[model samples]
Target: MVKQIRAFNQLKELALSQEILEDSRTKGVVTALYEALKSRDAEAIQKILAPDLEWWFHGPPSHQFLMRLLTGEQESDFRFVPHSISAFGPTVLAEGFDQSRSIAWVHAWTVTDGIITQVREYFNTSSP
Candidate 1:
C-alpha cells in the first residue's frame, strides 16, 4: 500500500540519520581518548570510561595489566591510530596501533554500552 511505502521510506531515513550520529560520536570518542593518552591524565580517561571496566590486549603487555594507562615513565609514547571502526549492537571495535615512527601494536579498545568496557592492548615487541 502507499502508506506502507511512505512508512518504510521514513524508517529508512531515520536509520540513516542515526547511523550518521553514531559515526560522529565514535569519532569524538576516538579523539578524546587519544588526547587522554597524550596528556597521560587518568582523570581525563576516567571521564569517558565506566567505573567497571577491563582491558585485554591481544598479546601480553610488557608491563603488568593495569586499569588506567596513565602516569608512567614511557607514558608519552602511548598512541594509537585506528585503521577502521565498526559498530555491532552495543560494541565498537577500534583496531589500530600505539605507533610513532614504528608500526608496533601499542593498544586497542573495544567499547560497549557507550563506555569502554574492554581494552585490548599489546604494548611490547609485537607487530600489529
Candidate 2:
C-alpha cells in the first residue's frame, strides 16, 4: 500500500511539473509576440507566427486593430497594451483596456511548438 501511494504521488508531481512548464512556455511565446508588436518588428513577428495563421475577430469591424497591425496598416495613434496575461495549456489569454478610447480587448492566442498558430480577438467585451 505504501509503495502504491508513493508511486501515485510521484506521478501526480510529474503531471503538475509538466503543466507548469507548459504554462511558462505558453506565456513566454505570447510575451515575445507582444514585444514584437510593440516594437513594430515585422520580421520578428513573422518568425513567431506560423505562415498559415488563423484569425478570428468579434465586435465592430473598425475595431480590428490587431489585424491592421499584422497587415502593416495600423494607425500611428492606436496601441494594444495587454494588462493581464494568463496561460492554459497551449492557449494564452491577454486582456487590456484603453482608457482614452474606452476600449476593452481580449486576445486568445493558440501557440504550438513555440509558434503562434491562431488568434481570436474580441473588442469592448468581457474576457472569457
- Tens-place lDDT digits, model 1, residues 1-128: 99999999999999988987776675566557767765666787887676766756555444432332452444334455566656543455555643344444444455554566665665455443
Stretches of candidate 1 above 4 Å error?
A: 63-68, 71-76, 81-89, 95-101, 106-108, 122-128
- RMSD vs true structure, all candidates: 4.0, 2.8
| Each model's lDDT | 0.58, 0.90
lDDT, residue 95, model 2:
96
Leading candidate by TM-score: 2
Clashing pairs in 2: none
Q: What is the model-wide C-alpha lDDT for candidate 1?
A: 0.58
Q: Please provide the root mean square deviation of candidate 2 (C-alpha atoms, Å).
A: 2.8
Candidate 2 Cα lDDT to native: 0.90
Q: Against the hidden reference, what TM-scores do the models get?
A: 0.65, 0.94
Q: Ten residues in a row with the worst lDDT in model 2?
A: 119-128
Let me know the TM-score candidate 2 reaches against the reference structure.
Answer: 0.94
- Model 2 Cα lDDT, one tens digit per residue, 3-52: 99999999999999999999999999999998988999989999999999
